[model samples]
Target: MGLTQFSFGALVRTRWAYALRGSQHESLLNTAYALEAAIDEIVFIFGPILAAFLATSVHPVSQLFVPTLACGIGGAVFFSLKNTVPPVLEPIDVVAAEIPDAQSNAVTGQPAPALQTAGDHAAPTPSPEDNGFRLRRLHRPYSAKPRNVLTYRGILPLLVVFVVFNMSFTAFDVSMTATMKAAGAERFLGLQLAMFAVGSCIGAVIFGSREMKGSHWRHMVMFLTLLTVGYVVFRMVMGNFLILGVMEILTGLCVSPLFATGNLIVKDIVPARSLTEGLSWVTTAGSVGTSFGSTIAGAVLDASSPHMSMMIPWIVTLCAVPLALLGWFLARKRPGRGTGRATNTAA
Candidate 1:
């Protein structure tokens, strides 16, 4: 599952870069992200309900096959669309002038031609031989050297913010479940979760349609602070179902926008050559946070009360604000490190 998700994420990022490549890239990317988030939440809203129905009406293990079948069909359709594939961009360092004609022919096991120079001191323009050499180099089977995406400034702190933010969201889920079960209203758990997804879908649509301006760091700080406040409200109203449901929807309003902002940050900081890997790292961080959050929240719920479990998310989210501020400071200190405007030729 991890491998599959990683591949899918990389492909999605590559496609987005290819399709949205112009002056309006930022706005179009935002809309694409919003649509993606909305569709994802819609799937989440239905997937669990369907799984529950299958578990109750059919065999205990039948629910698993639904996702397997869906993935198979979806993968088939997605991969079959050949036109959507992005062009492979080679590094600009391997120019025609760099490799001599003789060495290039030798690498390809072909006979070498006589060398021609413009003059002793004049700069030699690319000849037919040089062009051939460049073509061969472009078509060669050699892979470019791998670059470490984490070495980029501000990326680590941005990822840390995501990790903690996702941990809080996942913990909120466990706390919600604990609260519902303790209240003897476990059947409405699906409804409550669906409300959160619905709210997120709405938020994604609204946020995506707008042309947001200003620093992404400030956007993140604002969203995180708002979400933290929502969680606090969640803890306060856990005992009241109606009020809790309202709070759940309100809190969810920040979820998709926050995720979209994080992806934008990654896109801004990481070089185009490493964009896919950088985005995949964000997905991986979210997965890790989800796993840890659920485990910790479950343990806390078992040992204490739902309110205590809820506190974990509230406090975690509160801590994320300072981390985001730190990221902003670090990014400002380094002028061109993650400016996103400069084109990096190095892979």
Candidate 2:
């Protein structure tokens, strides 16, 4: 199941990147992410209801058939759109061959004569090496040797933020379940969770529809701060069922935008060649955080109380704020670091 999820997530993100390769506009990327997130939230909102019905009406195993069929059909449809698929980039050597002879001399470690003009004062042409350097700088952002995604400035901090942010967010799930159980209203747990997804879907639509300005890192920090505040409110209203439901909806508002912005940051920072891998890492980090948060929240609920479990989200989010800030600082320190837009590259 983990492998299947990882594969699905990686492929989906890669496909999105490919589909959006032509348009590097921030608003377009945000809208695409928002739409995808909203769809996911809709699935989350209704998937369980359908599963429950199937399990109750038929065999429990029957619920799995729906998703299996959906995956097969979705994959077929997605792959059928050949025009949307990005072409595999040509090799560096092939690209280099396209350069003019004067520029290519630099690449081949050969010297070329300076430009001569009709007048006595000849034009002072740049050296072959200088021309080559300039050509490479113009063509691609990264070095000939591809570096690991984590090696990029600000990436490590951003990934750390991803892990912690997801951990805190997911802890709410376990805490909410515990809270409902403690209140002897376990049946309402699904409704409570669905409200959260509903709010996230609404938030994604609103966020994606607008054009946002400012650095993505700063945007992430702002959203993280809002999420932290929401979690704090969640902690305060744990006991009241109706109030808790409302808080869940309010808090969930930040979830999709937060993730969508994170993806934007990854796109900005990672090179074209490594974009898919970088996205997969983000997905992996979230998965790891989810597993860790669930385990920790469950243990806390078992050992202590539901209230204590609720505390985990805000606490971790509080910790994540500094990491987000660190990412912002690092990004600022390195000018032109993530400013280079990624192009389609071969695997």
Candidate 3:
């Protein structure tokens, strides 16, 4: 059959996969995919050894068949289901307003309501700031909208806590990899990485599905605690390859829900006008934290024994506890923790 004839079937399959697992599963799926990649890397490292052993055997062609079939079948399955599905909105009475006099609306309007912009859509105009505070008088659209008059005094401090916790997390990825290599656990490194990604996928599936939507902060707090425990576990048992991998995986798994729920919290407390800008700052900060983590881990590893280097990452991660606490405190102040109400159009 022609490619066109099979296109609908492909779309149906993609939609089904995405439906059974929400788009959030896309991140979890990536975790599983990274495990598969780790497996591939392992195979690449071992292939030459196998080839040399088989060289003197009776049938060398047998090896070629397995690799070929594996590649072909995997490719066929993935490509057959490579289709993008649009978001299905559950009927929502999204409030819309009429623009009275273009110039009047431009002068007095607030930032336009968050909407999915297409290629033709224009970016919103920049807000005018006065003495560091954006002036509400200059933006008519935002000023006209119904102001949500709710304040949770505790939320600001919590944002700081979340930021600190993230800095610690950023350290883990760099430190763990180098420490494992330094400790002569290099042979099992591939397996360790595989487990890390697989565990994260499991975590994402657990939280991304039904368990997270209602009252997620309680669960989120529990997850953060798990992350702390996981780090401590690593600190206690540095040389044991198996235990290190398990701890890393556990730590990695706890992170996804924290991230997803944190984004939810940011949408709730901040002014609606600053939502996008706030998220961008959060992302940029996390990136910076990771970069610092790499540097810190590298410096520690270079200075002392392999064991000492491994301990530093764990220490840094533990210090980041304040940030997690701050995030939790802020989240507590905000109502509907992870209920998804505040997240509407936030993404």
Candidate 4:
């Protein structure tokens, strides 16, 4: 009925689209998303023209309705054009069902023993450095459960990094709009966003076209540092539209690459069976960050200058860099190639 509900629906729809795209590819998923993100930015290039046209209409919400329709039609065409049918998990893969005792245990409603492979027998050990920190200890419940060990090591760090990254993004977005409006160039907002998208397109193409060697976790920190630099440069040009557009190109290039890289990294790190779920958590973290970012940015802009509000995003971006680096460090000790089914294999 309102913008809130429409936004929530769109969020759900986007996650579904990503998951669908993910299911269709084993390689170059990041590249595909990167190219698509670039093309999507073209919409913003035409945005001012579209907004001008829509402004002449009786209602202002035509802007929202048009994009929503376009998205729906696009999704329909994509699904209809797909050649392959979705795969079914076959009965033979259920080792639990084949084992008579486990089947009986399940039928009696008792918990079945978790199936363990040869590799899973080894336990996660703390590094010498980890022994120095109190927080390094797994919490009470997890520590109490000796049989249940943490499978994915990068998860906690990834979660922390994504939350901060999205928070910074949301804060920057809102603050930029406010700053632009205050400066009497509200119309330039879309252009700046488009320019950013253009930059992202370039990044996506470059990274997507190559064979990325080593762990993706390492590149994530590098990209995040680029993001921080962009934000810092952005602060200098906030009062100047021409310079802002150029800055957007530099900053915008970072977006899709970051997202594509993050997506690929998630795919690499999580088990194949849980890929969609892992990606969904990224979406969830973004949503949570957006909510917080919006509240914080709106409050700051009201009480202080846009320049002051701008600090929120850059600070958050700075925070994400180290967190991502930490995640990178953790990934090494954890050691998963993140190539879906091959994660169990040694690097």
Question: Top TM-score: which candidate number?
Answer: 1
Range of the 10 consecutive residues with the lowest summed lDDT in candidate 1: 338-347
Model 3: residues with Cα > 4 Å off, grouped in runs: 1-163, 183-188, 213-218, 271-273, 327-347
Q: What TM-score goes with each of the models? A: 0.82, 0.80, 0.50, 0.69
23-79: candidate 2 lDDT, tens digit per residue: 646337678877777887899899998999898899979999999899889888877
Scored against the true structure, residue 26 in model 2 reaches a CA lDDT of 31
* lDDT string, candidate 3, 301-341, tens digits: 77765556555554654555555555455555445534323
Error of 2 at 38 (Å): 1.2
lDDT of each: 0.78, 0.78, 0.52, 0.66
Q: Model 1: runs farther than 4 Å from truth? A: 4-6, 23-26, 93-144, 335-347
lDDT of 2 at 70: 90
**Could you tell me how far off, in angstroms, the CA of residue 104 lies in candidate 2 after the best superposition?**
21
RMSD of 2: 8.9
lDDT of 1 by residue, 200-301 (tens): 888889888986777777788898999999989988888898888888788888888888877777777776767878888888888787888888999998
Comparison by TM-score, 1 against 2, better one: 1
- Lowest-scoring 10 consecutive residues by lDDT in candidate 3? 1-10
Q: 19 in model 4: Cα distance from truth in Å?
A: 13
Tens-digit lDDT track for model 4 on 1-347? 33322233223323433455445454445456566556545664676568767967646777778777876886566556444323432222212213335677788886755555678866455444333333334334422322211257776788778888878877987888898888787876776666766777777677667656656676677778888888888888788878877887877767766766666656656654455566667666777877888889999999998999988877888899889887777766765443433421122
